[model samples]
Target: MAEAEAGREGGESTLTVLVALGANAAIGVLKLIAGLLTGSAAMLAEAAHSAADTATEGLLLTALRRSSRAADRRHPFGYGKERFFWALIAAVSIFVSGAVFAIYEGIRTIVGEEAEQTAVLVAYVVLAISFVLEGISWTQAVRQLRREAAADELSPMEWLRRTDDPTVKTVFFEDSAALIGLLLAFAGVGLHQLTGSALYDGLASLLIGVLLTGVAYVLGRTNKGLLIGRQADPRLVRALRDDLGARPEVDAVVDLLTMMLGTDQVLLCARLDFDDALGAADLERTCVAIDADLRERFPDLAEIFLEPVPRSDPTMRERVLSRYGESTGLGRPTP
Candidate 1:
């Protein structure tokens, strides 16, 4: 987080997110007041959820700050993955504090609370205002995420799946859920007010909890995978192979393997088949070419392992033949 205080800077990304976080905090307090005054269980649950989100946003910003740190002897790859780790923690907190708490409160009301409806107009008014504020924050987050994903050449949903930074992705999804949930809350509160039925509000809260829990689970799995290291995407592997094969020194890509060390970092162990006549000198040049191409395509790679084998080597040839097959000439014989 100290690095964020240093010279590293992005255009209003920190400021905007921080402001939005503050807004959620303020809105949460207001909703709490409104809930207590009207005895609306749904409003109280919404207040808790919003407050939890506010805390999460603050955590995300802090992670972003930490992730901007420069590489050093301690962490040679820099602190980029720190964001993912911290965000995973935040996601778990969302489930425990926001979703679980809301669910418990909702169940209690469903079983025991009478359908008390006092000053329906006031509840509607407060909810409408909260909706606008939450909507604005959600829209802003989405717009920013959309632009970032587009720059990476990915669809919004696909971008979420591929994104290395969990802080940004988590905030985007959470805000989206919150936006939809607010609408649900409005509908539930309206119905409860109209019909004197506590079921509507409690049910809405339950659904909102479920939505948060699901998002939390997804975010947790994704971040956990990243933290433990995952394989580079298959499509990217194919692209790397093709690029290496295009080099004159590399006769063929015999075997290719990649492991992710961090978000954009990769460790590749590749076996390239070289011509039998090529000596160690030529083979080394091929290795250099592969390294160059990999760096050109993905500069963040942490390590590369290139093993050069003779094209005529039986092991290499057999493997290639198994995949691509030999001419055989069995279909047509020379007379």
Candidate 2:
């Protein structure tokens, strides 16, 4: 049952990434051809950025596939770390290919003599078409985001921080970059057309590069945090605690530690002190009951490690009995 669900999820993410990949690839080629013919530095920079995004999306797709591999003798916990590792690579590509390359090309154009466009009409048409396509990609990204956001009852930004899925994260970043890059392209081309100065186009490219760099830095930090086994979610933690507290066998949830191993899968470790206990057999039965309860509560909970023990030593038990009305985990007998 779990394996079937996992396959469905993997298929969904792959589909999303592929849509983003196809859009970026088409845009990059069009922009590159347009930029070269019209001598628009801004368009050239945009082309470079789109191409970088295309490569990053491809890497993310690869990561998603490898991360879903089944656990075996080599690795007991499964290959979930592949997601974070490749996301890191995507972040680096944004910095080097998109940011650095664009900045360098922009500077080169700025330093050279200002050149007039031989075909202003050609540049305008390309930018207009590019803008429309970029808008299409952006819309798809938002649609995917809204669906995920609805589940958490959160705004777009709120969802970004909370969502652990790589496809949603990658598509959001790429589409955002495309929209902003389109604006920069317009500004650069419009300014150059207005003043007949190549310098304006170059200046716009430089600014676009700076923006991409900042975004890359943010992505890098986010991916690094995920790779380090960040806690699943604060809300999940609270929910688990509340559910456990409601259970008859569970006295109080002492502490529960959870880490996200994949988008929806988590590893949960709980130290639970039961109420009044009876014999060894009773305790074992309680353990089985507690495990069953958690599985029912959380469908996506993959692995659960539980420790069932008494609340205190003999002296501590006596103290608790005296202070509170009764001791926990083998409390005083009822009258």
Candidate 3:
């Protein structure tokens, strides 16, 4: 069931990114044409924004593809972190290609270096159309996120922050920034027309740049954390501990550790003390059973190591005794 859900989410995310890519590419061409025809700095900035989004979508597609490669001897942990790395690249592109370009153009326009006295009506039409397309893309991303959050009984914001899939997060933020950029461009164009000043258009472009920068910052930070080997959520850790501790064969769960291998992969290592009566064969069988059960319960647990530590192990018992200044045998059955 977990695997099915992950596949479903992956499909949805792919669809979302494709839709945004198509919309951005189409809008980008139209915006560039409109910007050239109208000579509006705000329209040009919107064009740059759409171009950046299109490029990032392509980058994200590459990330998804590369990250899905099967694990091999060379990369035992798989290529999961590749997604985070490419996503980080996309975020940086947004800052450099989108924000920097917009700000530079805005400054030039503001300084009267490239001011256009006449604003064309076609820019408004293009802005309106771009808004509608971006809105559709944004809606798709939000719907997927909300559906996922509802399954986990989490709020949308909470889910957005906690979701491991960076592709969906990137699309959501990109579309959101696109919407805001459209609004800013609309305002700038409207103000320039009304006040006969190109400064408003330039100011609007600057604001759009700032908005893109902020979105890029968030994306970069999130991907950076994932690339740096962020651990799985605390709730997941607690749940794993509780579930394993509840097993009758387990005398005590000494330690449990989890690491995120990818957006949909996790590595679990558990140190468990089993019943003393369990023979070597029984211990092996028990470990197999536990591994199967854990994988079934959490499909994301790609790799699991169940270390069966004997309760009567002198080294461990002595370590525990030293820490507590007393010996309890740690549930070891007395002869």
Candidate 4:
């Protein structure tokens, strides 16, 4: 059942990326034509934005495909982190292709001799059409996110912050920025029409650059954390610790560690103290049984390691203390 659900979500993510890619590809051409016709700095910046988004979608598609490969001898943990690496590249693309161009254009327009705007109506029409197309992509991203959040019993914002998958989040934020960029372009054109100065158009371009820069920073940071091996959700960690502590053979869960292996995948390591009365054979059997129980209960656990240790081992206690400080709750007496 868990595998089926994962496959379904993966399919949805791919569909989302495809939709965004189509929309951005079309939008980029339209924006570029409109920018050239109207000679509007803001419109040109938006064209660059769409181009970056199109590139990003392509990279995200690569991430999804490469990250889904099965484990191999070279990569025993699978290629899950491929998603993070490609997503990181996508973030850099946005900054380089979109943000930098926008900023440079804005500055050039502001300082250079003023150029008269032409075919203003063309810009407006293209912006409106682009808005509709972007809205479609944005709506799809929001729908997927909301459904996933609901399944986890979390608010949308909370889920976004904790989500392991970056593709949907990338689409959602990119479309959102696209929609806002359209509005900024619209306002720039309107202001230029109202007043003969090209200053407003240049300002709009600068704002778009700043916006894309912010989005790039956010996405880059998220992928960086994931690449660095962020832990599984706190709730999942606590639940697994409690379950292990309750086992009949486990005297105490001395230490528990968990890390995200990929989207919907986790790696767990636990140091446990078993009842002293258990024989060596019994200990082996208990470990096997515990591994099976955990795998059944938590389908996300892709790897599990169980270590037996005495609760009173000073070295082990110190190691736990160094890792978790005073909040190291494992092996403590019940209040």
Candidate 5:
């Protein structure tokens, strides 16, 4: 079941990335041609932005593939976090290729180093087409995001931050930035034509650069935090405790720890204090039953360890009792 879910998510990410890649690649080519023919600085900036987006999407696609590898002896936790590494690289590339270059071009045009286009029809046409294509890609990303968010019962912003899947998040932000960049390009070109000055065009380029820079920072930060060993969501933790505590043999839950191993996988370690009435043989059987039940409940839990400890130790028992309160729905005495 976990494998099926991962496959579905993989398919979704692949489709989203491919659509964005095709649109950006085509838009980049058109913008480059239009920029060259019309000598419009804003058009050139838009061309560079589209080219960078195409490259970033390719990088994200690679991340999705390489990170999906099954666990081996060398990587017991699997290659899930490789998605974060590649995403970080994409963010850095955007800053260098998209933000820095656009800003430079804007500054140069402002100083009259590049000629402004007096005939801007080609720029306008290219911008309009790019807007429509980018909008389509952005729409697809948002739809996928909304579906995932709904499943988790979270707002879009909350889901984006806590989601183990990084591909959709990256694409959503990139497409959003692309749309903004297109608008900036349009404004820059329009102002240059209206006021008979290239300064507005240059300023527009700077604004796009600022926008890309902000997007890159956010993407990088999100990936970095995930790569550094983020824990599984608290909701999952609470659910695990509630389900285990409901068992008649479970007296109390001592400690529970969980880590996200991959987009669709988690590792859980739990220390459980069973009722004192059970003998050694019954304890062993109970442990096995608990393990089976937990795995059944959470297919995404790739690994689980449940340690049965005697409740004779007062210090440890008291600590466990204090930690799990009534609010967790785990404090009720088992029937």
Candidate 6:
């Protein structure tokens, strides 16, 4: 059942990427032609923006495919972090291919010889069509986001912050920026036509560059944390601790460590103090049973390690305290 659900979610993410890819590819061509015809700096910046988004979706597709490989001797933990690496590359692509070009174009337009805007109607027509296409892609992204957020009983913004998957998030933000960029281009072209000055057009292009730069930074930081092995959700950690402590064989949960291995996958290590009365064979059987029970209860636990320890041992207590601080109440009995 868990595997089936993961597959379903993966399919949804792939579909989202496909939609954005098609939309951006089409929009980029249209924007490029319109920009050339009208000689509008903002239109050209938007063209570069769409080109960057198209490349980003391709990278995200690669990430989804490569990250789902089965575990092997070479990579016992599997290739889950592949997603983060590729997503990080996508962020860099945005800055290099989109932001830098836009900035340079804006500066050139501002300082270079004055050029007349022509084919104004063509630019307007293309922008209107691009907006509709971008809206379709943006709507798909939002639908997936809301559905996943609802499943986790979280608001959209909260789910976005905590989600392990980056593909949908990337698409959502990219499409959002595309829509906003279209508006900026429209405003720039309109003001340039009215005031007969390229200054407004240049300013709009510069703003587009700043916008893409900000998006790239945000995505890069998100992927960096994922690659560095962020902990599982805090709510899941608390639930796991409580569940383990309630077991009859477990006297205390001395320490519980959890890390995200991939989307919908986690590695957990629990330092547990078991009942002293159990014999060696009984302890072994108990540990096996607990492992099975945990796997059944938490399908997301891709790997689990259980360590037997004395809760009162000074070394163990000190280690847990140092890692989590005294406020955790680990290795201590409840009142």
- Which prediction has the highest lDDT against the true structure? 6
Per residue, candidate 6 scores C-alpha lDDT tens digits across 50-121 of 999999999999999999999999999989989989999999999999999999889999998888999999
What overall lDDT, based on C-alpha atoms, would model 3 receive against the true structure? 0.87
How high is each candidate's TM-score? Answer: 0.82, 0.87, 0.89, 0.98, 0.89, 0.98
Candidate 2 regions with alpha-carbon error over 4 angstroms: 1-9, 309-335
Model 1 lowest lDDT segment of ten:
326-335
The runs of at least 3 residues in candidate 1 whose Cα sits more than 4 Å from the true structure, single-residue gaps closed, are 1-16, 300-302, 309-335
lDDT of each: 0.73, 0.78, 0.87, 0.93, 0.84, 0.94
Model 4 C-alpha RMSD to native: 1.1
Residue-level lDDT for 173 in candidate 5: 92
**Better model by lDDT, 5 or 6?**
6
Model 2 Cα displacement at 88 (Å)?
1.8
User: What is the total number of backbone clashes in candidate 2?
Assistant: 1
- Cα lDDT tens digits, model 2, 86-109, are 988998998888888789879988
Q: Please give the TM-score that candidate 2 achieves against the real structure.
A: 0.87
Best-to-worst lDDT order: 6, 4, 3, 5, 2, 1
User: Which model, 3 or 4, shows the larger lDDT?
Assistant: 4
In candidate 3, where is summed lDDT lowest over 10 consecutive residues? 326-335
For candidate 1, report its TM-score: 0.82
Residue-by-residue lDDT tens digits, candidate 4, 234-287: 889989988888777888888888888889899999999888899999999999
List, residue by residue over 122-204, the lDDT tens digit for candidate 3: 99889999999999999999998898889878999998888788999999999999998999999999998888888999999
- lDDT, candidate 2, residue 302? 71
